[model samples]
Target: MTLTVAAVAIGLMVGSVTPLAFAHLAENTPEERLGRTMGNAELGREVGDAGGPLAVGAIAAATSLPVALTALAAAGLASGVLGRVALRDDGRVRPANPPG
Candidate 1:
């Protein structure tokens, strides 16, 4: 019962952060690449959404549900650390070009 509750809470927390990532992507992307970037983002998201559960299920089958969930939690932590490093920027901002 406690594990189920923790899983649901973690899932909700992770799901809630996706939109913030999308917003960051949208902001950093060049205007010309916006559509392609968004499409790629969507594709990646779809693949993750479909594949994550299947992978977890397979892991659970091979080992146990708790092990599988722990693996996922570790992966999430790794990704969060990597993302923070990759997205870190100094405070400098380039001025936007005046419209022609």
Candidate 2:
């Protein structure tokens, strides 16, 4: 049960983090929003491109295939987290709560 919960928890953690980090790629940016939107888009793709393989291989090496797959998924979650970090708001490209 613990392992099962751990698996689910890990899954949920990855599930939540992935989109938070990388949803910007799938966002629709208008012409004016290009500059700001691209920051996240580029970040999402780049991070995914750079990290995906390393994560898979590293996990595979450290553990078994199944664990490695989990790591790969975790990497995806990380990407999502990273992507969302720089996400721009719609309508104005700038967030309503711009940090002071």
Candidate that would win on lDDT: 1
Per-residue CA lDDT of model 2 for 1-100, tens digit only, reads: 7557656776686566556544433344455656777676668667866886687778778887678766655655675567556564455655533454
Predict model 1's lDDT versus the native.
0.82
For each candidate, give its TM-score against the true structure. 0.85, 0.42
Off by over 4 Å in 2: 1-30, 74-100
> lDDT per model, in order?
0.82, 0.62
lDDT per residue as tens, model 1, 45-79: 89878988998899999999988888877877787
Which portions of model 1 show Cα errors greater than 4 Å? 92-100
On a 0 to 100 scale, what is the lDDT of residue 39 in model 2? Answer: 78
Candidate 2 CA-lDDT value: 0.62
